[model samples]
Target: MSNKIKKKKMKKRWKISALVLVIIAIIGVVGYVGLQNFLKWKAPELSGEPKVGEWYRITPEGTKSANGKDWHSLIKVGKENKVIVYFFGGGLAVDEYTAARPLNDDGGFYADYADVDFGVKFGIASNNKENPFKDWTILAIPYSTGDLHAGSGEYEYTDLNGNKQILYHNGYINYTSFMKEAMKYIPNPDTLLIAGFSAGGFGTSLLADDIITQYFPQVNNVTVAVDSSLLLTDTWHDVAENMWQTPKEISDRLVSDNITLDSLTSLSKKYGNKIKILFGSSLRDEALSTYQSYFRNGILSTTNENGDIYEKDLAKMVADLQENIPNVGIYIWNEIEKNKDGKNLTPHTILPSPNFYGKKYSEDKSIADWIVNAVNGNINSYGLDLLDK
Candidate 1:
């Protein structure tokens, strides 16, 4: 073959290869867009008048599940100027296919919650007369993505069987969606209380900065409350960052010095005294500690011959959080009234317990009193408590 002919053939092959690559890229992008459009959820109708004190399953924006399935938030409208926004408690998981979240409108995210009824003590439960926040407009968010409610990446999770599943970490997206709709109901609230438990607590912390800086910059009476989502579980911190796309989703909004996935007080550490944060968790949170084993079972054993090894880890993490965050206090539950497991101290989430409103933190005060004091702008930090045995 002539040298000129061979050179021409090589050029032709190179051009063909380049064309094929470009075509594949285009197809991939188009396919992604098509699937997204197909799965996009519409805003649920929010025009009906909710009964004064009745809880209703209403999706202000009709926030759909990551896979376009039905998901809902529990809403209760009130005539008060104060508002409380809460997130439900559900275990964070890589195997969310079997995770406990509301798969439809019939059930609630919490085991004890009803579709349109209000329970007392939980972040969402403010229906009792003993609680000071009873009259505040309540908006309780539900978790579905199993991303600790703060992810923004489209990632893949591999189950125990080596099967890969694509997941949409859309917690941050849902936050924006719900917030926009929420403002319509509680616009210009005189007092805003934000709290969540377990996975939802992490979500509250993840979005707290923005909720203050961006959403309601003018609302000075804001208290960020956390219930039992001990972000200090260092074993799965990196996994959560990578799998949930934490850095990509919330790093810019965090906007502070050294706010990596390694930091236990990522939100409070950055804001310092500028933001008021209240944290709560039981020392012997069996359910939370048990769930922790799923992610760090081989790495950090929770149980040993002497006691739960994670206790040390939890202690250190809590201490570090106290030292790092300047304007923060904690409502710790070291004792439980009832110990079904026969352990010395049995407690998991403090807010969900009736103790949240009834247990005496002092001679004449309760957790609800502390919450009211915080909400009233009488801000003070350095709180660590133990419920009376």
Candidate 2:
């Protein structure tokens, strides 16, 4: 073939290939966006009797997320008589500035809505064979209201654009309503595990008492596990009292800046050996450290200094809890991960991570094993050496 003709033919083929690639890219983008939108607006429907081992998304009436979106929870019917009421974490909105901006992701100020699909295949809520709570019925509460699942009042704030906005801050209401619905399905569980991660970890510490006293009064075998929940701020009492408008019982315990520490301490004193308390966290949780930085420096920073600060605070908090509540079980793991900027960051919560089943600090005990043992009244600490490091 002539050289010019050969070149022209090659050019034409290349153009065709480029055109096809462009078309595929467009379709992929459209499909991805369409899927996201569908998931966001999909209405939940659960028909007939609750089936065992199947997850059902339930949207109880009067449940609203921070952004006024419809809130929902996930429940799975299990063959066992044990029940796990788990609260998922997002972030917190402590003030008007934070309330107006709900980032709906990790390290954000808060989440605007619950992710219905979250926890379907993770940790205690998963169907994984290695999961300790695999057969236990689950009531998974997704965080969205930005009040650590403890607020019941509406908060008004001004947006960055200067527009007035109202945040639901209705976490207390949402969980209570969902619990009522959950009781209808799994009414008489012999063993009840109340647990939460990050923001929800704070919730577990704050609300476990109410849950036990109000709902499962007859179940004596109860355990509470809090994962990676920490926020050092002096305004916690004020925020709990005025902004979140938490129950007096919960707010009154906020005599100190660390809500999780305060609540857990009070709970230990009140419940004593009646309820097993397990607390776990990374030595330098990136998410919690960033939040701590925000509270300390008025900016969200994930610096090595901030991480050191978090570690010091965590060590002190652990020591205080141990001194105040002698039997409290502690689990501290330091799993090195990376942040978006490629900086070294310790992972935040383990209960919802896939590693929950296999990750271990002790040679014979995985976090899951430790949790199972604790739930069975064999409370012991794991990963405590990480704190020394």
Candidate 3:
């Protein structure tokens, strides 16, 4: 063939190849987006009896997230009759300003909805041998409603953009609704653990009494563990009563800004030594300090000064709990991580993090080991001296 004819054919072939490459790229992008949506919204049906050691997502009817999306929970059928009801943690929205912006909106205050696969791979929810609750049947409750899993009201507030919005703070309704369905699979338990982290930790303190008295009353060996939950606001009682519309029993317990302390103290008084109560926290949790700064100064900050203030508040909290609830088991750790500014800050929560099994309170005991001991009724406090550092 002549040189001109050959060059013309080569150019045509190159054009066709480029077009095919663009088409292929478009298909790949479309497929990836579709898969993500599927993962986010898909709810697995609990058709037959749940198989042993398998995780299943259960979406109960009439349950909704803070953003009005359908809410679902997770369960893992276990080898033993013992059970762990774990509440997952997200941030909170105390008022109109915080409510307008959710975690997805870069508000940094609260998560508007729960993801199906939130905490399945770490801490107590994991299948790792190091997890003491690994084989225990787990009913994992995901948090989204900003009410710490204890609200039953719809709150209307004006957003930062001056748009009126209604937040469905339906945490209480979601938990009860899903627990009713979860009971069908793991009906009766000889030993039970009700636990949570961060906002869910506060939920553990607030809802443990009602949950035990209502659902698993017959389980004698009951334990409640609250991890890394602290929020100091003088208006908590009013917020609980009017904004969240929590049950009167829960609302009544919120006489002070320290809801975790109030709830746990009251629960201790009611249950006596019948149930194990455990609490865990890092010395200077960065995320919690940020929230505390917002609550105290009306500015969200994670400065070392804010962290010191959180530590001071934590010391007071620990002292108050020890004074009021003598039997409560405390685990305080000083696990440091660098913040965005490269300053040292203790992490927010440990129970749902890899550090649950990796970090140790004593040279001999991992946090996992301490938890296992508490579950077996050997209640003791660890790392109390860390408060001074």
Candidate 4:
């Protein structure tokens, strides 16, 4: 071969080799991150005790977030024995069974907290013109571990790329540690309302009864209000039960509650009138429709999953649950006022929402009045506030 030809071939060979190396490196990084993206967490067992009538951030001893930092909750002082616990909602970022995420793929958002001055920024925490629980003490728990902030899990799963990873799913761990210490501050609450929206709402359904039971002796009335988080389906429930370690976390000991990770329908049925449970959701909430998609996971093509169908199904689910479960009331809303997207946020999160006060749901009651009923454990007195689709 000629010298010129040989030289040209050698140069081309080196270039091809470099490109191959670059491709390999990119794949290597993706694989490494995929292996690390397991949706799990463990909260350290909290030691010592909570202070009474004092505000402090309770960091669980051994609990670590997906970002590898300790997670904590902020407590604010309020009236003696009357408190409102609101679980802050953020989207769940992890789906173990190869389901595509609607937004970001990282579970790190589960523990993400913005240290805003809740007393001023949050209307629910402060005395607003229409808030009923303005004077009540507030306990805000931020969602950190992606397991709907509901699982107490230590699990392993094989990702889509065939990489095995371990997940902590330590929401139960975080709650147990926080609640145990919370008792010190809330020794005897005459009325306690546990409320949350979105993923936090789902978490409340799983965890609220635990609080009622823990303070059963002293609490005269305990109510739970779950907002825009009616994400229950048989398809994803089986996966969540196994992969998220959900069984024990959902088993409510407060009442003779027959716990099942299968569907909320039966769970609510068995929970008839045990404690007042109130639910609220928008007819066409975009945010929740995406989360609700998680319930069908692999059954429907993730991309083709019908949002309208899911939204109607969700509304129907809430309506049926209310009829089946006594003391279980619901406030269903629609786009009856000036809303941003018209269809989506007709009313996503009610308690923390600016529309929580006015915006009539019925002729005699506003959203604020319905909430008061929820906190007071009133049931079957309100009808659906559905707007035309």
Candidate 5:
């Protein structure tokens, strides 16, 4: 072979070797960077102070997830002899559950938005902010756990800080654990109010009777306020095919089903005036339809082993209880004006009143006033300035 050819071959071999080394080095750097990120990455935390009208946290309770993640609970102090432990309706992922409404890409709905805030505000104002009731507290638990907040259902919200926690999926049956942990942060046990709206309200009624009765009997006082909860008696499942189809339908079914309050009436009998219930309802509401659809879907039926058509068959449980329980008071808002032009307005969370400042929807003073009266133990007269105050 010629000397020139041999030199050229050696030069080519060197260039190929150098190219291979560069590629290998690049691959190694990329892998190391990827692995480092995988090890260090964490979900963002949601944190903040309670709004002015809202209650602030006094003690933070630590929570451990099934996976062993640690979290803390927040609190809002009330003044009345009653402490309201609030469980918010659906929406958002976590921190925003306590917020008036979750700001979703598709917009939000439900009377619960107004119901929850109004209830809280009423509690604060009824006592004239002096909190005549001692050791009163409000626990606003955000929905950080399920898919219940999707679409317009986004009630729970988490912000930039990884603070607000979620409900453990299997935790409903195990909610006692969360309740037990919550007791640690409470100011007192003698005076406690457990309440919620929509599904939350339903859960509160169920838990108040099942868990509160079996476990926390020392809690001499129990006040339940449910605004359009979707729960009816277990028997209601027989006619609940429409329960999972629409919000308005669901509301009608639940109201008709006779589920949530059926067992509540008996509480007052067992515990006397210690168990007081406040129920707020609207005559015309479509949110119930939305809920009926959500609940009547095949999943809950199959899980509970219920027959078809659950919503219809559900005893007008609330209505039936209303007739029986003298202490279980209810306020029915007969005519709710929805629009400026006088269209038939459905009772919804977002309002048309101008009171809401940072809220995503309009506000209504009538609902707010009613809540104030209910929380203060005044059922008959709700002092509201619908006109010029």
Candidate 6:
């Protein structure tokens, strides 16, 4: 063969190889795009509301006295005609938190609380150890920024990726302003049981009195259960008074704080006999030491110079109520800690995930049984005598 002829053949072979490589690359890109689209299309169906679930989102604007914030609430109505309204705590600035909330829309993280369901069944067992409600309706609200609620000012907005969203500024006020507006939908106050874990629990205590007096005067007739809450004590009661002070008007003398212990005590009084305050505590809770120092001293000292809190002094409160009030049911579960270092170190933080620390209270039947007792009105037997002393 001639030299030129051989060179031509080699060039043709190289060109063919290059063309084949280009074709393979195009096919690979097409397959990757299709796979991503398929996953995106299927993700929504999985995240949609469960068969027995109902979801609601509420935004309460700030009022005149209190600057409002936005918050998300999820109220899951159980099988039995009973309802549990869950208040979730998240975000530093109100707008940024609400903007990334999971209840309204499904992102990478949603329904990460003990209340939500897993594939096989609900992750958290009921007090009865059986799912009581036929259905559950969840309400989510953004309680931090006024933009979400009726409070004054605005909050900075951040994107889904945690990038600086829109910079917004809003006046700071606690969640009472938001709760007051939420009372409009008490959902047949008679059958409602208000409960929250962590920050939601704090909000429950803050709103318990109002819900009792203003919305559910029959709170004595119903159950108010809280899990992993009642830790941080607030200072002011209503936007108006502080029960710890002799004059009640002394709230004005204090600096601006969101919640007060006096408010919780006074709120506890309205439906004294009817309201059932149940606490779920973990002895080794990593945040316990920090919260005890920060919130206990911070708020309790202002009003209760003696320095009292539900965790440390629960026995005394139980006794005092037993001595005076009738039919005041209280249950306390001293949850055993599973991990020493705290597996869910950041569970309580605004960032949500299933990585919880302490022990798993949901699967424990004892915790479920206690809840069932409260539901059936049999909780009066839980060492009422202990509270008496």
Candidate 6 structure quality by residue, lDDT tens digits, 1-389:
43234333332111101112222333454585653443232111223333344433333343221122232233333444445544443211122333333222322111212212211122131221334332433333323331212123333344557675432222123244445544554455346565544444455554555455555565345555544433333443322231111123223432334232333344455555456655443322333333343334321011121222333444544454444445544544333333453332111221011112212233343444555567667664342332343
Q: Rank the candidates by lDDT, best first.
A: 3, 2, 1, 4, 5, 6
Per-residue alpha-carbon lDDT of model 3 for 133-237, expressed as tens digits?
888999998888989899999999876567888899999999999989999887678999998888889999999998899899999999999998987999899
> Model 2: how far is 224 from its true place, Å?
0.4
- lDDT by residue (224-315, candidate 1, tens digit) is 88776653333344545566676554644433322222333666666555566776666666555544543343121223311253455456
Please write out the lDDT profile of model 2 over residues 38-156, one tens digit for every residue: 34443245666788888888888989998888999888889999999898887788876567556722224676767646345556687878887889998888888889899999988
> Who is ahead in TM-score, 1 or 5?
1
TM-score, one value per model: 0.70, 0.87, 0.88, 0.69, 0.49, 0.48
Q: Candidate 6: what lDDT?
A: 0.35
Which lDDT tens digits does candidate 4 get at residues 1-389? 43234333332110101111222333454474542341122222334554443445667577654333567766765655588777766655445532212223332223333232232223355455466666677777766566666667766656435776655666667777776766676656678777776666777777765666665446657677777775554334544566566655463221221121222444455555556777777666544454444344322211223456656666567656656675567777665234343332333555555456646765577656776776665564344545224
Tens-digit lDDT string for candidate 5 (167-237): 23222322444456545544445565666555455555545655466445677655666655543334343
Candidate number achieving the greatest TM-score relative to the actual structure:
3
Segments in model 6 whose C-alpha atoms lie over 4 Å from true places: 1-52, 58-80, 90-129, 134-190, 216-220, 230-264, 295-327, 335-365, 380-389
Error of 1 at 222 (Å): 1.2
Candidate 1 CA-lDDT value: 0.54
**Cand. 4 Cα-lDDT:** 0.54
TM-score of 1: 0.70
Candidate 6: 10-residue stretch with minimal lDDT: 11-20
TM-score of 6: 0.48
Which segments of model 2 are wrong by more than 4 Å? 1-44, 104-107, 338-342
Candidate 3 minimal-lDDT segment of 10 residues: 11-20
Error of 1 at 175 (Å): 2.3
**Of 2 and 5, the candidate ranking higher by TM-score:** 2
